[model samples]
Target: MTWITEFAPTTEGLNACIDCGLCLPTCPTYRLTGDESASPRGRIAAMRAVDRGLMPVDDRFAGVMDLCLQCLACETACPSLVPFGKLMEGARAEIAAHRPDTATIGKRVLFGRLVGFRPALVFLSWLLAIAQRLRLTDVLPSSAAKAAALRPVPIPVPSTAGHEWLPEGEQVGTVAFLSGCVMDQWYSDVHVAVIEVLRTAGYRVVAPPNQTCCGAMAAHEGAAYDAARMAERNVAAFAGHDLVFVDSAGCSAHMKDYDQWTEGGSDLAVRVVDATEFIAGLIAKGALPAAVETTEPIAIQDPCHLRHAQGIIEEPRAILRAAGLEPVEIDPTGMCCGAAGAYQLSHPDISDELGRMKASQIVATGLPRVASANPGCEMQLKTFLDDGVEVVHPVEVYWKAINTRPVRQAWRALKTVPRRN
Candidate 1:
């Protein structure tokens, strides 16, 4: 095998890299280290070297590759369509294949077991909640924490773990709502709001049975085999739906690239839609509920996956604008919030710097509420230390506010619909 094939590289994957370096200004690690090795192109070159046997998959290779936040910023900036996200994921898979057991017992906490099971997620949520209730966070020493920003945002066990689904009257189409691995524990309400917003737009929303984490986590961690199994499960489970609505941008973005995950590819690729895109689609069709009257400013942070992976730039803003709120854009140009999966835990220093910068931008907007699509962003942004700034999902932004009567009224209609759909 040649350079391209050594690390399980594909001709298509390598061909995708045009080396324009549009990703340079946007890469957080590159911005920090000012090293080519930290840039996406530099890392790609290293992967190529490892593939070609010009370089060993030694500590140096791992050191350079591991520096990436893998924020997908490059994907948005790339003119070559490099699929840098998958490239990094593949590189990690290469690393993990040759790497040692790095997962701590707590960190590993039944990841395989929780992959497909909701009960495990619920249990973890309760555990996190218990840790919170016991003030265990305060007891955690400095050694246990890297910085205030890198600290884990434990998932709360909500008063209602999840609300019972009620579709509003007649449905427009069928959709399967994916309960993600972490979101089920942290921002499950955003998903609940997704269902509410969808039903409001006249869709029959269903949480697909036995759905698991979209294998994005495993794929990025180099477990493509496990990732494929998760994707296959979702493909089969959501087979007959008119659409599959994934609330988390990260999961939706990865699933959209299902072709890359499977050697044989999946047919369910086209039906998957991100929540923002779907809601925006409803707005386009004039099925969107009336916008709410708001007297507040909403600071918006674009998730890299939503913006770059899916080419989704406007739907979320359309939802916010139609809802009568001012959408204040965070003007970092092309920065990621550094919550690219578990990057915060893996590289705390860089993650903290990015998170603080992002939070400061949100705070400068002087908005009491901040909204984004991905749950990882939600958890990461929840640590924003500004006085009185509450971060929320855009769906939650509308559903929780009383001023959005049409939106809420749409939810009212959902309560009256038949549930067995």
Candidate 2:
């Protein structure tokens, strides 16, 4: 009945918690439920007990662990620099090793077989888009309807795979792009924006068709095997490129920790950078043109992965400022919007409550447009926020600002190299 594996939490991470109570205020579940079992400290305590054989790894323990948003806000607040995110993933992997229920089985299939396969994911997205257009989701059960509603209007995925975009005049450097699973299928426009912005910054962008999912969702759900396989594939796909740019916050954070998943991953992990972070660096170098005009204020909703996990809080804001947009902070506490990957679909009730809370904070800012780096957060905000509110990636906003300038457009037209396979 023991479920301990190499993926289970380590004693070092468990013992690192000093019971400081600092993480209590940062945990969304604890703040919402006011339960000790919901907070990071409490969860660590349970993990310790399970590690020591004092507590059984039963359904109750799994429930407690699953309740967490795994947003890693607590890790940001922890002075000890505890690897809580890693520990949590390990614990979940252990639980998944022992628990093989209907839900877990479904997740395995979804993350392993479907999300890992780009074509299958694209086809599924097409089906979802059609279903949404036909209003067929309304007829599904409540849970299924909620899942279906998460999909944004699907756009044609640009032909970027196996192709490269060369910057005009002089290429600064070459960087690989991760056209992620859901990102490529549902939010392909963001990829286009990222590539355009990067190209504008004088970097050659390459989309390797061999790259697959970053395995963030699988790792989050305890499918470590699938995640490791993905890490290996990505490491090989993006090999020889010194820098790899990822547009999705979740994928960026996960890829940054690829070393933890597979050997040779550290080589890829060290090179992975968030697209916004890369753009911010380019702005600092004055490689990109200055903004000709300023836009209206936008509410900046920090995705948990970007703000907390990667410690990339100011880069996106700097990019917005460089693009001549006023960036408004929605929540200083860095609370989760409840869209923790597929967390919204699995825990819709808690997800909705947190989504409403985040949406309210954004609405209070009174900004018509919101910049969120992650697709999940953007979708969650779109679902809960008013119809007048707009959610877009920061790079998308930057692309718009630069693309609208006449001189820049002229320069782009002359300098932009055609896509080459």
Top model number, TM-score: 2
Q: Write the per-residue lDDT of candidate 2 for residues 367-406, one digit (tens) a residue.
A: 8888999988987888788779888788888888778768
Q: Please, what are the lDDT tens digits per residue for candidate 1 over residues 16-82?
A: 7878888798788889889999998898888777666788766788788788877778777888878
Q: Per-residue lDDT for 380 in model 2?
A: 86
lDDT of 1 at 184: 65
Checking candidate 2 for backbone clashes, the offending pairs are none
How many steric overlaps are in each model, in order?
A: 3, 0
Q: What lDDT does model 2 reach?
A: 0.85
- How well does candidate 1 match the true structure, expressed as C-alpha RMSD? 4.7
Model 2 residue runs over 4 Å out of place are 1-3, 137-159, 292-295, 405-421
Task: Say which candidate scores most in lDDT.
Answer: 2
lDDT of each: 0.70, 0.85
